[model samples]
Target: MADLEDPPVFLGFDFSSQQVKVAAIDGRLDVLHQSIVHFDSELPEFRTQGGVHLHGDGLRVTSPVLMWVKALDLLLDKMKTSEFDFSRVRALSGSGQQHGSVYWRRRASETLSQLDPDQSLHQLLQDSFSVSDSPVWMDSSSSQQCQDLEAAAGGAQRLADITGSRAYERFTGNQIAKLRQTRPEDFQDTERISLVSSFAASLFLGDYAAIDYSDGSGMNLLDISSRTWSEICLDAVAPHLGRLLGAPLPSTSVLGPVSSYFVRRYGFSAGCSVVAFTGDNPASLAGMRLQPGDVSVSLGTSDTVFLWPQQLRPALEGHIFCNPVEREEYMALLCFKNGSLTRERIRNQCAGGSWEVFSAALRDTPLGNNGNIGLYFDTMEITPAAVGLHRFDSDDTEVSSFSARVEVRALVEGQFMSRRVHAERLGYSMRTRVLATGGASSNKEILQVLSDVFNAPVFTIDVSSSACLGSAYRAAHGLVSESGVSFFDVVKNAPEPQLVATPHPAAQEVYPPMLRRYTRLEERVLQQRPT
Candidate 1:
């Protein structure tokens, strides 16, 4: 352990939808203190009046870019008040929700300050796209975009063959295409495009345009083997868009010192290095201290399962997202859009009302709901192949009419079974245990259900902010001599987990039939043409 007098403190920022969580950890990966600051643009005063439009994607509202600037400012202000010395915060890094792009025109002396204050630039680009809001990863309106790309690249299988992944509307490539096809003027004006994670880092470092491989891979334009934007992808996309795609940097690269302006504005120490940023999923994988055969299941706004692969293999019928870990090391990933939200909806409408009552009802429902029903949770399942939208057939149409207990059970069971099929398709055997994290994993009933469904031990770590903790681990390992201490050692030395849930035998016996039903439903659903 390092001495407390001046031990290095690695700071990790998790820029989430609900809150921005900032955490600091010492050299030994011990938590120092953490702060969560919340902000909402939905307030009447914060909301824009005439400039916004309710696009098919969602609300296309424009706030002055300064809102983000002020939000970060307030976040730092709160951090300063917490008594944690900003100087001790040596290296800084972050994890953000994936796929949202921040565009900027390249110009010397146009620091983030100038960029932030320039409402005209935002308005100019906004007018160009005519769609004010950037389509976040959660936005699924890119169905048309996905279809076009699939047709152009010779169907889903062919496109997956070239890019090593299927087309998803949330991917940077599709969003760029959407802008180019619909808003040519805006597409031409875009000088550079960046992911949200890299954009936040650029705020501190001033001019760096590098994106971490983890976030870059999510763009569906990045080549997994080369770990760079694919020329083929660029060629396919560049004709429609104008901005130059940036090269991907390793997660550990020192971006540069915090901008002198930011240092003065936020009272940060000089020479504080800002490391490259990654998506929350990759960061969470690091936080969970994942190893080969070790899977990390994050149950956030969405649900994701990540496994450290020995090597990259394009398996799982394109359900797998393969990206680099450090250098040659890679990660295999599966994400579900409707995870906790589905469960919450069930609790509210079907499970006798309230989460407490839902848990009690689930306990009494017995294994497999006595084989009377199954659930089809499809809140988010765009990846592997974009299904466009949910459409329950004649038989399932009644299932969607109203929320019922059996229907909810079917939805939950269906989602878990979908994940199982995905895992199996990726050539992952059932021997691996799952390390579950996020809000959903905290619920005892959900964990038990997951345990029984997957038939694998589900373990929850002691730290709630696993992504931040993992980023801290990466930052600390990057600072000291490589030979002195290893990244694995940092993970190994981290605190013990909070709980472990093993599968119940009765449920385990019942899962096989449920799994078969789920496979049939998924196959039938995917095969049917969208109405």
Candidate 2:
């Protein structure tokens, strides 16, 4: 460690769905301080549930733009009260929940560039947004817009080929299309569109910040291959959209110095560089130090599987984003909407609502659950677009149910099997190492099924705030990225992930047949379901 008298530090911020968090780290990757401002609890004036408002339709979700601003103001104040040395920060980077957007009102730049150190950000910028309630990632009310964009791009596959994804309701471009069609006046008043990632960066830069490519890939308006906004897509969203979005930057770009506002109010160093902020997913990839051949499985409320791919394989399902750490490469992500909750439903029904009993059931069952398979989707699933519980036995014969013990094993196996199939569908073959994160990764039993399904060793790290940590790591890497220092080298000594589970000896023989059967069964279910 360097001299304690104002030793150099790096900062990372995560403007997430529910909270605004910051992590300060030393050069050696040791965390010096962590602080958070939760929007729902601390900023109750917003009256938000889990940081967003759920409309009556249950699909139109939004958060107050000023709420995010106020949370940031509150978070910085908390950090200041703790006597954190902000002046020691060498550089900073951040992330935000992907796909969400912020619409800056006309003349918003004037307010941003002229921020007064004496006034809080929230107080002065109350009217900065064109849309006070910004549509967030949870919003799925843009299906008409999604269909329109897909139709404009030729087809779903054609759109995916260009933008790294089909037109998703939650993507920024579709959201913008909806805004223009539904709220034309607000769309007209919008001067600039910033992905939540870049919006947070703008607060620090005191100017409009360019959306980074990694986060921009989620927008359905960017050409993944060229790393530029597609002119075809721009015309599809709105008129003269290019002027509003400006240019996209690489995730590693060092934008500029911290704003004078921060320097004066928060005592951040005048020389502190603000690196390009990216999406939370990309930041997590950087934080986890995900290598070319490594796969990351986050077992949270919604399970997500992502891996750095050797080649680009854009498909209708899943997504491909420009890699944050490797500019020349890309990352593939497959999200399962029915993850932890679906598993919990099975645990409660079959294991008496006890995780201990759930684990025992899993341990008691053999690999492949003796050729029984199931798909339990408590809600709509993203990958297959299918819901409801389906079960089958060794002969691929449809079965209404199975024993409680079998149901437990089938739930775990089915979830991982679906992940493997979808990941491979995205052109990612099984890699040797699987890095597991999130709340459920702590369960060794669940991880064993994951390991077996992927036929790889599963590893876990002590990551509480990966997005923030990843941004901090990005800040360090950005400081020397121009000199050709790799991200791996910058965080090589931070900490080693612990190997939690390895594939069983019979996994190779057991899973292939079971997976094949599951795939066919899934197809049958999809075919029978009404559109």
Candidate 3:
């Protein structure tokens, strides 16, 4: 056994929608090596008689098993070519996108030796469920199902109060209920269901089912206070479905080992402990070294502004999601469905050809675009939850036409202001600092707007893969059995941040009125919607 002073090297995996990123960290908390493997999106193929079917998105439609074997094959090949030793790897774990479920069956042969690398056991379970693809977190087809579950569990508010989130379409409970209603035969076939994070961990350990608190919290089946599945809520849907759900494991629990088969195939040494998994957001927070008063704004396809909170509270009326960091620690998260993609669209349409040109245009344009007569960037309104709400309102007297520069600034400012309002609602004071990540963090213009809107400093780390690093940190912390170091200690001493942006005092005054106007517009739009 290694001495407590000689902490073992750990590997963390971030299983994202676009790609799989693998990162390794040494005992001193230095990132040793990192690699990213991209997977082509499974395009929907139309079959005249069979209807439309999608394939090749990391799974077989017949069994719905995650085809990480292919992804792992590519990753391991890369590692081998790079001459990264797998033998010294002491622990492994992962951070995965939340809300996805994976199902697996326990092999009859309990011995670790019987778990063959080439076994197609997942295929044999086809008769159990017709799950074709592990529904990615981005799949929102279960909206109606979410509504049903909300009603079943006692209205949206009650469900939010209990689960710490309003039932989302992609959440596990809604997805399970949808499966049960649409394909009763398949639902009955399911022996066990697990989140993608847990499933990835299982792959390394040869265990079929186990869930981590961070990922389980996103399921809409978990009781926030108890940190367990809600029996009353489960019974409201179906007791059988509840039986299929896995128990929630703490973030620090050591699930098992990298199975011998995996060890042999990947060239990793035996006894490499595999820690339980967690959701990507909490992992990002850990990676960024977030503490009280530190806010991280993750701007991916969907944008989420998360901050550590002093107390655990349910999501407000419109906002519904909680941080799964720990039972006592709280995270207030504000999410927007349209984030980077919307910004990209605007860049393509208005910024001519380059981000440099866009930045230059934004810089040349004065604060508030010289009090632009009729300019506002919608970028999808946060309130009223209406799709395509980014369009300009003719009734607003602000602007008649927007220049390319004005349009760019409006989009940047809109997103920042949204974060500001969300943080305020969460009871964060103006003194809080904002730490930014994801695609938007790369844009200096956006960061400036973020700083100005929040009237706080914005810091960006050099590492693009914060979520993966966070996962590795969790794995390392989980491996500590004897007087090990804390996660905060690890991250605090890990690396130095690169860029920091301070708020532009001149623009601070301009943003407050603009934010107020934006809120009014949002309310009007929602009120006009037909109930």
Check candidate 3 and list the clashing pairs: 61-132, 373-398, 373-399, 374-398, 374-399
TM-scores, all models, native as reference: 0.79, 0.97, 0.82
Q: lDDT scores for all predictions?
A: 0.64, 0.92, 0.67
The worst-scoring run of ten residues by lDDT in candidate 2 lies at 1-10
The digit string of per-residue lDDT tens for model 1 on 346-420 reads: 677776657777776667666675454443444426443434334242244424343355555555555666677
lDDT of 2 by residue, 1-531 (tens): 123486679999999999999999998899999999999899999999999999998999999999999999999999999998888999999999999999999999999999999999998899899999989999999999999999999999999999999998999999999999999999999999999999999999999999999999999999999999998899999999999999999999999999999999999888999999999999988888888878899898999998987678999899999999878789999999998888888888999999999999999999988888898888888998998889888887879999999999999999999988888878777476999988889899999999998899999987788899999999999989999999999999889999999999899888888888888888898998897
The Cα RMSD in angstroms, rounded to one decimal, for candidate 2 relative to the true structure is: 1.9
- lDDT of model 1 at residue 504? 93
Q: Rank order by lDDT, top first?
A: 2, 3, 1
What value of lDDT does candidate 2 attain over all alpha carbons? 0.92
Report the lDDT tens digits of candidate 3 across residue range 200-306. 67667775547776677788888877778888678755666556776777776788778887676666768888888777777777677777777778878878777
Candidate 3 — which residues are off by over 4 angstroms?
1-7, 41-66, 77-83, 105-113, 117-132, 263-267, 300-302, 311-313, 316-327, 341-361, 364-384, 387-399, 402-408, 481-484, 506-514
Ranking of predictions according to TM-score: 2, 3, 1
